[model samples]
Target: MSQNTLFDKVWDLHKVADLPGGSSQLFIGLHLIHEVTSPQAFGALKDKNLNVKFPSRTIATVDHIVPTDNQSRPFKDTLAEQMIDTLEKNCKKHKIKFFNIGSGSQGIVHVVAPELGLTQPGMTIACGDSHTSTHGAFGSIAFGIGTSQVRDVLASQTLAMNKLKVRQIWCKNRLSEGVFAKDLVLHIINKLGVKAGVGYAYEFSGPAIDLLSMEERMTICNMSIEGGARCGYVNPDQITFKYIQERQFAPKNENWARAVEWWQSLASEKDAKYDDVVLIDASQVEPTVTWGITPGQSIGVSQKIPELKELSIDDQFIAGEAYEYMGLSPGQAIKNTPIDVCFIGSCTNGRISDLRVAAEIIQNHKVSPNVKAFVVPGSEKVAKAAIEEGLDKIFKEAGFQWREPGCSMCLAMNPDKLTGNQVSASSSNRNFKGRQGSPSGRTLLMSPAMVAAAAIEGKVSDVREFLKK
Candidate 1:
């Protein structure tokens, strides 16, 4: 068991009682709901004749099924429209705050909460979406819950769960030029193997992590679930505090001072003990891209895919499957692999900073004639910020579409989807088969800058080349 780490501290702080089966009843400080998952839970609540236990603690938004292109009344996708309508009616009936489309706050549930200052240190946050671990970037204990657990949170505001062991992943040095948080996290997942984190909560720390901005930290934590970790977090510091200081829902005046004081105390002690620890040199990580089905099946853009014998026994089967699905040879280099679509958005890398980085790399360049490229901001606020800074103009002039804020092609629940066997250079997370809405569509995950570079070249190109000049 880990002791005195942020995970331990936050878990203990939120533990309401010891359940009979060695699991603790943990109180969720924040609950976030979306259109796709909340409808079923709300229906369950109606069957049980229950109301949201703490309406103010929960927030609602429509994201998963909302089309990024046409968001007019009565969505083109009838089911999507019904989902959003149900969420709206449920939120109103329960007196919960709902950030509807065009509210300027509505977007991906994960992206909207943090920007609004609803995600803070030492809180236990739960969402009905897998990326809820994104809130952990603020030194909180957060994780995704099933629909049943969503109902549990709404009805009682707590969950029964056993504690997870803590693993401290100490990154030694700063990332090299052109290597963003996305690349670093992909590298970490590749090295650790996806299931290495099955029973653990990852504590991401060290000088390398400390140097990242809040948005970058969010990117790292956002994909912890992809690595099979229950959740991931960075210790709160001046960087975290600065990011939260003046947001819409953040504490004000003297409350701000007190909040910071408390948050500062939540970092792990210098001598804290962890159940496990791993160390890596972040400076060595390069622009990374997924070549296979899972997030862990990735290599540096300049490296060749590993041969089956070169992979561990546990990974060989998946490697073979990935090779067939991706239509690539084991010894082939990932570079120059043709791409059909270029998508740059999602809770993973859809923030204003992400757009700015992609735009910078795309300046004076145009999307390849063979590629379909677009950028979807994470939220209405993110979209507004990018437009204010003229990012939209840069993208449009570079032959990329600047779409409305929503989850977009990350999951392909909307109109933005890949057709046939099209290959995509995507900044969004996940490369699972059929994940982009085409049974045969292939997705290669990379950083936003890398996605931009690929969009320009119509292949998997090293982003560092663009950074050199």
Candidate 2:
């Protein structure tokens, strides 16, 4: 059992009681909902005739099924229209705050909550979306639950789960030029294997992590679930406190100082014990991209795919499945894989920083023929900021469509979807089968800048090479 690590500390602090079946009854400080998942959860509550517990702690938004192209009410997709209507109805009945389209605050729920200061240090955040862990970048413990668990939180504001073991991932050295948090996480996931994090909550720390901005940290933590971890978080620091100091829900001047004091104290102690510790050299990580179905089936830009025999027996089986699905032979270099589309957005890497990096790369460059590329901001605020900086013009000039804020093409629940077997270079977190909206639609997961490079080349090309030229 780990002692005094951030996971253990947060768990112990928020644990309301120990429950039967070896699970703890943990209290949630924040509950975020979206149109897609919350509708069913709210319906379940109505079936049970139960009122939401602690409605003030919960916030709602529309993202997953929202169309980035046309967000007008009475949406073209009747299913999406119904979902948003349900959320509005539920929030009204429960007296909860909702950030709807035209509200200026509407966007991805995970992105909106933190930017608005609704997610704070030491809070236990939950949502019905995998990237809910994005909130953990603020030093909060955030969990992504299924629809059933969503109902649980909506009704009781409590969760039943076995405690997770804490794994300290210590990253040493500085990232090389052009590399970002997305690359570092892909490196970790590929090295650790997808299942290695199944029973743990990762504590992302060390010099490399410390150097990343709050948005960058969110990108790292957002994909924690992709590695199969139940949750992940960083310890609160001056950076964490600074990011939340002036936002709407965060404490005011004197209250912020007091909140900062409390938040700082939540950092894991120097001698804290952990279930395991893994050290990674940040200097060695290159621009990474996912070549196969799973997030773990990734390689550095300069590397080749692993031969199935070189992996563990189980991993070899997993690799075999991936190879068949991805239509890539073993030992082939991941570079120069043909791509038909490029996507930029999601809870993982859809912030203003991501857009800035991609637009910087595509500024004076033209996209290749037949490549359908676009950028979707994580929130209305991110889109507004990009327009303010002229990032939108750069992208448009490079032949990338600048769309409204939403989880566009990440899960393909909306109109922004891939056709046929066309492979996409995506900045979103997941690369699962049918993830980009087509069962046969392939996805290559990379950073936003890398996506831009792929878009310009119409293939899975090396981003660093473009920079050098």
Candidate 3:
């Protein structure tokens, strides 16, 4: 058990009661819904004749199935259009705030909420999507719930769950030039093994994490679920408060000071105890990439793939599977692997900072004629901001398609997908089999800047080489 940590404080503050089986009934301060997962939950509410317990606390948006290229109404995909329609109808019936297409606020559920200042420190946030832990970057305790839990929250505004142990991941040293936050998280997941954080809430602390911007911190927490942590968070500080201060839904004026004071108080005490602790030196992290299907099967760009015999028995089984599925051999150099597509988007890496990094590389560089490349902003606001800064022009002129905001190729629920056996250099998280729509397609996860470098070379090239230019 952990004490005096942010996880403990937020959990204790929101605990409504302890149930018979040792599960605590925790009240959720915010509920976010999306088209793909909400339809079934809203339908469940209809079967029970229940209305949202707190409509104002819930927000709705459409993202997964929305097309990034052609977003015309009455979507060509009948099922996608139906899903969006159901969400719109349900939000209207329940009187919940819905950011529909062309609303200027419409985007991925995760991106929309945070930008609107709906994600604040010390609040318990829940979403039907696994990456809901992204909101935890603001010092909140956030969780990704199942569809059944979604119904539970809508009807009662609370969840029953066992508490998690806290693991303090202390990062030290400053990241070297050309290394991005995405690379840091990938390095963490690669080192700790995917399941190391099971049953634990990760407390990302230390000077290295503090140096990261709010969006960069979000990138770290966003993939916390991928590392098998129940959730992950960083203590709120000046960076967090500055990011939230002028946003659309942030507390304003007289209330802003009170909010800041309360948020600051939620930080862990200097002598806080944790169940476990792991220290990592940020200087050792390079531009990292996922070489195999799982995020755990990753290696630095300059490194060679692991030999099967060198791995532990438990890891050998998956290594063989990865070798066959990825069409890669043991001890092969990870760089120079040809890629057919390059993508820069998703809740994980589609923030404005991500775009700026890629744009810096795309200037005076052209995408390889053999490669297909595109950039999809995470939200309408991100898209608008990028356009204002002329990032859109940089991408378009560099032979990359500039797309509208949505969860594009990240999941491939929409038209942005990889064809059979095509290899992709993707900025989005996850490299699972068949994750990018095509059953045989291969995905290599990397930072947005790495993806840009790959797009230019038509192969996996070291982004540091481009940074030097």
Candidate 4:
């Protein structure tokens, strides 16, 4: 058990009661819903004859099924159209706020909420998507829930769960030039191993984390679930408060000061005790890429894939499967592996800053003729910001398609998908088999800048080379 840590503070603050089964009844301050998961929970509510207990505390957005292209009403995919329609009706019936497509606030639920300031420090946030931990960047205790849990929150605004042990990952030093937060998180996942976080909540701290921007911190927390952590968070600081101060839903005037004061008090005490601690040197992390199925099966761009003997007994089986599925051999260099498609979008890395980084890299080079590349913003706000800065123009001029906002190729629920057996350089998280829609599609996860460099070279080239040039 951890003492005086941010996780403990937030959990204790929201704990409604200690249940008979040793689980705590935790009240969720924020509930974010999307088209894919809400339909079932809303249906469950209908079956039980219950209305949303706190409609105002819940916010709805359509993303998972909404196509980034041809978003015209009565979507070509009847199922997607039906799902969005059901969500609209449900929100209307419940009087919950819905950020529909073209609403200017519409986008991925994770991206939309934070940009709107709906995510604040010390709050317990839940979403039906795994990456809901993305909101934890604000020092909030946030995590994804199953459909049943979604129903629970809608009905009672609370969840029943055992507390997670806290692991303090103290990152020393700052990232070197050309290495971004994506690379750092990948490095963390690779070093810690994916399952190392199985029963813990990660507390990301130290100088390296402190130097990162809010969006970068979000990228770090967003993938905590992939590491098997229940949630991940950074202590809120000036960076967090500044990012939230003027947003649409953030506190204003006198209330703003009170909020910041309270938020500061929620940070982990200087003498906090954690169940575990791991130290890392962020400067050692290079531009990284996933070479195999799991995010943990990754290597630096300049490094070679692991040999079977190099892996532990438990990881060897999956490593073997990954090798065969990825069409990669042991000790093969990940660099210069030809890429067929380059995708830059998703809740993980579709912010305005991500687009700017990719655009800056792509501006001087055109996409290779052998590669298909595109950029999808995380939210309408991100899209609008990029357009204002002409990032879309830069992408288009570099032989990349600039698509509308949605989840895009992240999960490939939409039209943007990889064809059979195509190797993709993706900025989005996850490189699981068939994750990008095609049963045989191969995804290599990397930073947006790395994806841009790959798009230009038609291979997994070192982004540092581009940065140096």
Cα displacement (Å) at residue 242, model 2: 1.7
State residue 428's C-alpha deviation in candidate 3, in Å.
0.9
TM-score, per-candidate, Cα-based: 0.99, 0.98, 0.99, 0.99
Cα deviation of 277, candidate 2, in Å: 0.5
Pick by lDDT: 3 or 4, better one: 4
**Of the pair 2 and 3, which is ahead by TM-score?**
3
lDDT of 4 by residue, 304-376 (tens): 9999999989999999999999999998999999999999999999999999999999996999999999999
For model 2, the run of ten residues with the poorest summed lDDT: 4-13
**Regarding lDDT, does 2 or 4 come out ahead?**
4
Clash pairs, candidate 4, are none
Q: How close is each model in CA RMSD to the real structure? A: 0.6, 1.1, 0.7, 0.6
What lDDT tens digits, residue by residue, belong to model 1 across residues 1-469? 7999999999999999999988999999999999888888999999999989999999998888888888899998888888888989999999999999888899999999999999999999999988998999999999999999999999999999989999999999999999999999999999999999998999999999999999999999999999999799999999999999899999999999999999999999898999999998999999999999999999999999999999999999999999999999999999999999999999999999999999999999999999999999999999999999999999999999999999989999888899999999999889999999999999999999999999999999999999887
Candidate 2 local lDDT, 182-265, one digit each (tens)? 999999998898888898888899999999999989988888888888688888787887888788899996888788888888
